[model samples]
Target chain A: MTTESVRVAVAQTVPEFGAVDRNRRRTLEIVRKNADADLVVLPELATTGYVFESESELADLAEPRDGETASAWAEAAAETGTWIVGGVAERAGASYYNSALVVSPDGLEGVYRKVHPWNEEKRWFAAGSDLPVFETPFGRLGVQICNDQWFPEATITQARAGADLIAVPTNWVPNPDGDGRPGDWTAGVHQAVAHADANRVWIACADRAGTERGTAFEGQSVVVAPDGVPAAGPAPADGEHVLAVDCDLARARDKSLTPRDDALADRRPEVYDLG
Target chain B: MTTESVRVAVAQTVPEFGAVDRNRRRTLEIVRKNADADLVVLPELATTGYVFESESELADLAEPRDGETASAWAEAAAETGTWIVGGVAERAGASYYNSALVVSPDGLEGVYRKVHPWNEEKRWFAAGSDLPVFETPFGRLGVQICNDQWFPEATITQARAGADLIAVPTNWVPNPDGDGRPGDWTAGVHQAVAHADANRVWIACADRAGTERGTAFEGQSVVVAPDGVPAAGPAPADGEHVLAVDCDLARARDKSLTPRDDALADRRPEVYDLG
Candidate 1:
């Protein structure tokens, strides 16, 4: 099952902390400008800030899967005739899940709640138990949010579930004492590249930029090919901008140089107690 | 025992393919400049390129651990009054092993052969079964080369054997078709970061860069803090470079963030039969 080539864009910018309306408007504007793209991505918690000071604040910003924010994105997708992948605080039952929503021309296609929460995220969001991937005009796309990117199992699961492209939306906070050095973000990008190389799948990562609530955002948003080479994004320190690139999905499925399945084919999971 | 803080520089650079003299000269220059650094690093097979189409070429580059090239680095370490860590093809018995050598201010401190031959490396180098770490002024440092970076068992073994910092010397090849975009090297860095984060230890990675023998190098030589944030080198298209950073060995021994030597503390090695 080969896939066709598609153009993807990663919108790297800083959203106002807890300013949902402003964030949505800016996102829509960026989406409109890149209407020609097959897929457009935005950062995790793009509507809400990474720092959730209180449950009350989370409740205020939390939205149902079919809420206004989702509807707005759905409408934007239909208008642009493109697929949109972005992060939002999802209100599921009595709890909230850090989720990534995939909106298509038809409407909301899927929502992937972050499987692993990092540090403070545990204080607010519940962990997701299920993993899912979906078919799109571009390819079989899998969506994951921030913390989920850190785990190898997360991306591997998506690949096992038949995902061709893995899109991660992240509101990554820059190291407070990193002294503005580029190395501070090595772990984050490492996961993305490893998954792409190991799974032989394309990865599109959109990261938030600029300072919000005393946290500086390191704007190294990026897109990687199956062999783990950066295809797009990962802009410089001051680059809080949009990056677009055309990617051939078939190229990612090349199994000669990097046998995607072979990397995980022999995994003996019975002994790995990664707690 | 309490450990003292020591500044170690993991020099990540791209060695010219089969350019032994030039690569060795560059290594000496970096060692000289980073004289104040307790330890300086170089990538795997620094004297030879990663992709050797024929066995003759591999054998031609293969040298004894006490050969001229290794001796040169040893002399440099003594002259600069610092330790040097790097990768090389070693001649052992009737076979060859991809090895990492730790040259100290006194002389060759220790040598570790690659435990797990990765991909093409299997065709060239024999695997070494033993795992060990050495004592240094900063702390106990463990050495591993390339593919060894992917396995948690290897790292956990080093930690169990008493290592404060795990230094990986790698000649990582970039995707042949990657167009030099950011975030292209996700897998390599991901393995390093996860190892550091999960182990709650520091990881000093020295990676090779530049296009040698038609293979491209992604120069994201990184230093992962005990907290898992990476202090990385400049993403150069191709060339020689050094990524130096100050590492606090004492902080790595802190039990608050990383409680060591428990069931949860050590990774079980019996389960992974896939590699």
Candidate 2:
């Protein structure tokens, strides 16, 4: 199962609301600490945080597409010779986008905007049309942020597009209907595992920690194998945590779940209705 | 959450291979034992068993749509005032279909032919075209068999078709990559949870137990809540077990995962490339 071995790090850290400078420093410090890891992932909106008081406040704190946030991360990645993926609230021309910025030792390489905005984010951010897969130093990476993880189509599409791993930068809130059980009906963890197994792709979700504007975040940051089991930390429910796991990206290539079943090949898409 | 509360029974039992008469009797016994239950569900091909040695053997054991299997289950349901749903090897005209038979006190209410046949079954059965939703006394019921549950789109489409509960009669095989983690990777339990939570629908999978022809059946039968958590037994890895849970079918109606996020309403289907 070991092929193209890579060490991945998930930084589940808290971001101060509307504090761009502080959050940028926090993000840089977290990424620098994991310099030995081949790939480092940070939580959603790591540059500005979540839960805006107003659209104006979000705009005030948002960075430009090629802004200070990207430069800082690129510099850090270059210094560490690592590939970094993190979420940011980006100002794209006249509109704003909840984006996942990709940084490699070479430079800031790609940006993937959130396809499906969650809740009030729809009121602020423009939904992205082009979902790009990045051929990185570590592996082929697909980007998703927060609510986009809820859609199986997003993950399925990424897998078809040849992404070995889907990196989710998430600001997860506590599920109101949690039955004290962790998997389903609570958070997107099980969905991550489900999609990973079904699509034969590794899934690493870096979720935010602590309370922001009265909303508590679920910080069960996880790195799941293609086999649909956790290879790394489900972190802590609410805290700053660092988790690193050695992953063989090759295992994600074979969609064959068993001797008989090939995930995508076995799909009866012709009979399926996408409603 | 309580709108229409109904007691549903899942009988996780093994069917002797090539013994249709004995297996039919066994199914009747299980259903009669749970006579008090509002809805009773059994495993895939409960009357004929799984893993047929030959196409001729499968045809020999197959029952007509209105034959012994349906009549026995219908009689049991009528005598007990219960609605029964279970898998059967059906002889539809000259072609065979891996079907889920729905029996009420009235008689055979509906038959949902297994659309996506697993491996060898593809050689023996004709794939179904229409995936129908039944308006039952218990709730709006959607039926699927073993391998069909692997596809998220099938379940999501069922939810969209106005089914409160998706009843899956499955003969689950042990996952090739299972490290005994007991969730998504192992059984479809977490995938069931994931899809159910994403669509706000209750899912009940009644999987078989015991080994047949060197293939081990995973007997983790479960009834999951609309919130994507199990409400009943994953029975055991291998055993004869009966699980019953009183579920509020209405919670499945409110797709509101949070005050802000409505599962179906939030879907960006336009951007989804199911290809």
Candidate 3:
């Protein structure tokens, strides 16, 4: 039921606006470089850049699960014998949803739509209705997109659903209101660490670099251990990076924190009213 | 309904084991020092040092809400004309619970028992039944103990209940499994920051310093703003200090993150299923 350890890689790339074909080629290049990776992750909307000027531009760029975005990732996964999970601008019928696609060597394993869309994303895409965790050779995989990280419930739900690693494909931008201070409170890394510490889970956050149109992103991809320690890179804030980590995936399932404490088992759910 | 800005204080101290009388005296000294603070916070099991060997030891130290612990803190509050929230080892009838008490200039306001007790506290203390938010001159106040901070629902519930600040009285110990990295994931400060970021509420975490028996406590007490900024002192890891910050309590009620985003108002509760 387990692969013991997983050699994971995160490809942090900033896609050019509306350049779908060029982005797909660039993705393949990075995937090939990390040929030894068991699991590969990329930034959100990696095929098409974020920040749409209008609905027409979004409609033009968005593709379905079976489209070029999925096909390219599937080809890479099958060729390299790696599992790929990342975000895409998904088209369904007449509507589009921000989605995370899980692709294995076999093909597309599953897709989880971004449950909580960021600011203008509400205008471009419909909100997702379900949280999905896909089964893999290593363990169970839970996926989330940008802005979804802000909601603590998203991680809690996935952790409760038995996710071994929560893959985060994000296009993180600097907070306009954030007054940068030298402490745990001011950094984006805290959010991942908080959830990982509380849930006793592993988290891999792959964030894009460079600016899209007028919007700039913070690139700090990392693989966090169950102990809430960053097992790998936060990458450079402005550089393209291929972050890698060799992790014992089984640690995510072991909730025992102290000799007497089990993080999930010790929880008093009856007293908590999330509704 | 709004008090312009409230000056808050957090007293971080390490109590000597089996020295309740000296601890009480020490508590009064710190309360008198922060006479200008509108609200003050102290650490969990503030009087009785943690790391007990047996139930009999806990039984011997546990006091009633109106016992010496309350009266001493109450006397200080009355003299200072300030409100105080702190943790205590409470004995209700024959049962003991790790509790948070709200004391104002008038008298004892309310008590919130620690719902989620960490490690051996479970064996000694009865679990809490409710999460209470008390109204004060500054704003609504929510209270929690050490291990309770690990749960996001604790903060979310308080934030929804109109809590302006969550006063955390924590006897924080070093992570038994911590690798000592330079990032934010392993620290208790990050958890507060994450919840503060997500809920857009102020958090006052008063952690103790120094070692008790074989266990070491990490100090660094902080007052986090709604934007997840440490508005005050994280004190120091090895020293006993009082941390204070002047904050506009009105910001807690205003969850607006961006022009179109109100952090709490944007939560789609229907989609989130923690179970």
Candidate 4:
């Protein structure tokens, strides 16, 4: 099988908390400059802020799936003709979901609800039920929200579902007690790399920055290969940044090696109850 | 307050393929001879050997929770008056569990089934439904089997459950391709160290060795401190070995610097439904 290489970009920026218009504008500016890429990703909850203190706060921040934020993202995708995946809050009737939306030149391709809600998020959003993978211009792409990266099963399931490239949009918080060191919040990145290596898939993780409600955002967006070898940014300090890399989707698929031979193929789901 | 240091012996040995009787005999001999240690640990699947062919093979090797294996282990514990934790095939009804039995001078204290089975194990064993932490003469200890160590949740849960020390019994296979090269696998050791640092607990991981059914076991048995520093062996070779270290439980409990807090406390489990 032949492989194809596509140029991918990760937009790393610091979005003001709850300042949707400002964040959206800043994101578009970055996306516009990186139009040469096939795919681009942004941070989790980039449309809204990370801290949702009350039900009123969450409800106020929530927007429809086809709301203004997604429409703006779709417009950028159409203009750039590049696939985009990023964090957004979705409003469906009386409920709200922490979700990542994927957009292409054609339109809003799909939306993946963040399956794992971290800490305060549990009080705000309901859990997502399905795992979705989409076929993109570059290859098969999978989307996972911020905290979802911590679970091996999330990434593993995506890989098994035939995603050559997995993209994560995260609002990763830097370890405040890490003696103010820049590279201290690397555990998440390392976990992403291990997931890529274990599944033989390329992973692109884009994170937002700036301190939101005293929690400092770590913006070390990174891209890793099928061998779990890091290929791009642990990007420089906050502000607006773009990390571009040539991702070989075909090569990832061709070099696909499940560490353990077809472990998923032999799963006896009936006998075991995960709940 | 004066802190006391206890002699902990981590038995990092390589068991012969499918040699349950021999391995048990060696374990008993080691326990009888090593009178200095307050606690001892053996590798995962130390009894039946790792990489068994079929469910029937695992079943054949499986012993009742209170059967021969437990009796022998309990005898060693009673004779040495040392707390022992080791892996064995646990048979209950028609189901088989790759379990770790914690045997002390008093008797069999607790059992933990391997939570996340790797590779071929999915075919022979069922995933554990519950996580259990037990109290021992030495300290409050948490037990996990093999791949469970890879996930932060397993260790974090134990810490939350008030475990002072975490013991992992693993039959870890070295990367066949990683002959002399060093990279992520070495850095991956930080995962355990991070756990120790974050939770202020001592972590002792004993892994098996030797090529069994074409799988090469990498015997990197290690003991890490509450500071996330190495206290003992990432042993040099894949052979019969013993790594001894002095673990101060009180010191771990006293450390003020921790990796858990609001920003760090950010974990979203509701979104991780795929697993």
Per-model DockQ against the true two-chain complex: 0.17, 0.55, 0.64, 0.16
Model 1 Cα displacement at A94 (Å)? 2.2
Candidate 3's residue-wise lDDT over A81-186, tens digit each?
9899888899999999888889999988888899888889888989898878889989888898877778888888888899989999988888767664443222
Q: Write the per-residue lDDT of candidate 1 for residues A143-248, one digit (tens) a residue.
A: 8877566445566667766677888898766433334223445345656765687667889889987886677767788888877677875665454688898888
TM of each candidate vs. truth: 0.71, 0.94, 0.97, 0.69
The candidate that achieves the highest DockQ relative to the unseen native structure: 3
Ranking by DockQ: 3, 2, 1, 4
Worst 10 residues of 3 chain A by lDDT: A179-188
Best by TM-score: 3
How much is the lDDT of residue B161 in candidate 2?
86
* lDDT for each candidate structure: 0.74, 0.84, 0.84, 0.74
Model 3 interface root-mean-square deviation: 2.1
Model 2, position A275: C-alpha lDDT score: 54
lDDT of 3 by residue, B1-275 (tens): 13969988899988898788888788888889889889889888888988888888888888899988888889999999888888778989989998888899888889999998888887898889787789988888999888888888888889999998899999888786776445322368778878888898999999888898889898989888988877886678877899878888888889987787888877777877765
lDDT of 2 by residue, B1-275 (tens): 12489888888988888888998898899889988888889999998889987889987999888998889999999999888899899998899999989999899998999977888887788889877899887679999887787778788778878899988999988767666353433547777778887888988889889998888898989898987777986678778898999989988888886577788877777777776
Candidate 3: stretches off by over 4 Å: A181-187, B180-186
**Cα lDDT, model 1, residue A219:** 76
Q: Write the per-residue lDDT of candidate 4 for residues B185-227, one digit (tens) a residue.
A: 4423545655675556888888877787788777778887765
Which pairs of residues have clashing backbones in candidate 2? A185-B227
Q: DockQ: which is higher, 1 or 4? A: 1
**TM-score per model (chain B):** 0.88, 0.96, 0.96, 0.89
Error of 3 at A5 (Å): 0.7
